[model samples]
Target: MRKVLDPFSLGMWAMILLVITITATLGVWFNTERRNSNPDRRQSFWQTKNPQRRRKSAYVRLALDSFLQKGNFFCGASVEHDPNANLASKILAFGFGFFILITVSAYVANLAAFLTRSEFQSVTTVNEAIRKGYTLCAHPVVENELRSQLPNAKFFFHENGKEFIGMLKDYDDKKCEALVIGWEDTSTDIDFLSMLCERSLVFTDSVLAEISMGFPIRPSLSAGFSYWMYYGQKFEDINIPNLKEKYSPTEALDSQCVIQLSELSLQSADEYAMITVQNMYFPLVFFAVCALIGIILQCIYAFSSNRRSLIGRVSQLDLTTTGTTARKDRFLMRRRSRMKSRDGTQDDGRFRDSRIEATEE
Candidate 1:
């Protein structure tokens, strides 16, 4: 069972990630500045001077939260914004908003078909698989052609392709990574068709080899034309290789895996599904990393603010004590000076009295 977000493609999810990242990063620039029109304080958003990390991170969280539709993206973190930055941020928000709106509306309106299940992001072509060093499995009968087509891939061989497909569960195991088999449409058995539609196996249109019906056509046929050149019974137009719908009725094919894959594809075309969290691994992880950074910076800022306040309080106490001590010392000096002067005057008076008595005698 797919989750809520499986409807959106990986690329869509990637776009969402890109938008959020840009929004968050740009939001930080707008949020951290002091909102002064003074060009020195406000220039480009990329200014390198006193970039307050904690404040910006808080804004980062808000900017991302806006995409989650919690707040207005254009003005979420901006209580007051610098003129230039405010304009730029609004423009960015509008641009992202437009992109997401169009994409989301198209899906919601059913203009585009939503995926029924989460598709694994693996190699789309045999060439791509070869380049990525994938091990390919094939029957020994077609081993030569496969080797030629996939010149570089590692190979695992089994006598019967059906046995291998059954044993390895449609080439999903690590031992035999992938399989390449061939059969004629006229002789395509029910069992063979069922194997091709295994829910575990995804079909890519990449053709390693196409065995021509060996029936030659006239000179009207051009060279380098693929087997898709074969026309339908009427031969009115080129045929599309959509085999699933053509063979949707598989009553004889009682394979649970095949039935499930077929049913899922059919139902997904008409059903409404939300994107799953599993499909959104990248963006979520990115958000998590940003939030963590914000938290760390916040802690650092709190500690620094506390330390500054503490130092200021200690300095204030010192200043008050110093002033009080100076006043006390000045008062003591003035009292001592007055006492010395008074004592001198008294001594002189005593001296004059003694002199006067002696002269009288």
Candidate 2:
């Protein structure tokens, strides 16, 4: 037992138990009090009278009442019938109100930001583009691979090197929706297109497939060539970033290039200006689930606590009534005994008088 109740272990277990007990007790007590309190006396949580209202004249009150009523929907805290309950309760209420205000303000700001931003809806992946029936332009070498992967897709083929530059111009001119090229081909096209067009074209970050070059040579020379090529490739990889920077266009492009390139020529700017609510589905669902759970737990706690409190109050009332009834019965019994004694005394006195009269006779 001593080993089991070591200082560290005991302290941890004690803290856990204490927290659980305190939370459960508070929850039960709060739920019970809320249930016992009259609903008619409770104001809506959002309805709050301004502090200045107390000092205002009647005329001012009448004038502002309508405005206040309308504005109360945005208020975060409401005063009860007795707002002067306690310092701690008031402080807690204020803190809660402030928290709600900050949260609501932040949400409104975020919503406004989302609304004002240019709405972008594009295929983030190759499969998504294919599924949406988007046409793709690719180099001739990988046309077969693309056709195999995207069998139903409409594809335009371009030769390697400078010839592939036209595909980028075509895509920008709204001839094709996307350019599906290998990672190497994409790098090359970006370099070439960057020189030809003032606007730099950005490709999908997804790499469809990798292509490798093979050489046919005598076995004797193949080993030496393969070894040299391996080192040469590593050297080229190191300088690839420098090469890209050297070939990159002198003119800068705005961030809207991708959206501008993808949009159809016939489509209006208003179509792209439309709002797209992004990244809200999961969080909204999560918050709704949490709120529902809280309501359910609150209801269960209130019902249980209210029933318990009612039973307790009834038992107390019964005890008090029983005690009062017992005292009343005792008092009545004492009164009756005293009256009997007085009547007995009177009868004795009458009998004595009669005896005295007989003796005199």
Q: What lDDT does the true structure give each of the candidates?
A: 0.54, 0.49
TM-score against truth, every candidate: 0.33, 0.41
TM-score of 2: 0.41
Residue lDDT tens for model 1, 161-198: 45545534536556566666553441235665565565
Q: Which stretch of 10 consecutive residues in model 2 shows the poorest summed lDDT?
A: 272-281
Model 2 off-target regions past 4 Å?
1-85, 158-162, 186-201, 214-225, 228-361
Scored by TM-score, the top model is 2
Q: lDDT tens digits, residues 1-361, model 2?
A: 3322321234434432332333233322232233233344222211224534433364344335423432342243332223433333333234333433543454454444444544336666778887998878777777777777768788877653645666676677776787774445444443454443354334445667666766789989998987776776687653555677677533343333332233332243433222222323333344335434544656676687679978877577888998887677666655655786777855466655654554443
* Overall local distance difference test of candidate 2: 0.49
Model 1 misplaced stretches (Cα beyond 4 Å): 1-117, 160-173, 183-188, 192-199, 214-361
Backbone collisions counted per model: 8, 0
Superposition TM-score, candidate 1 onto the true structure? 0.33
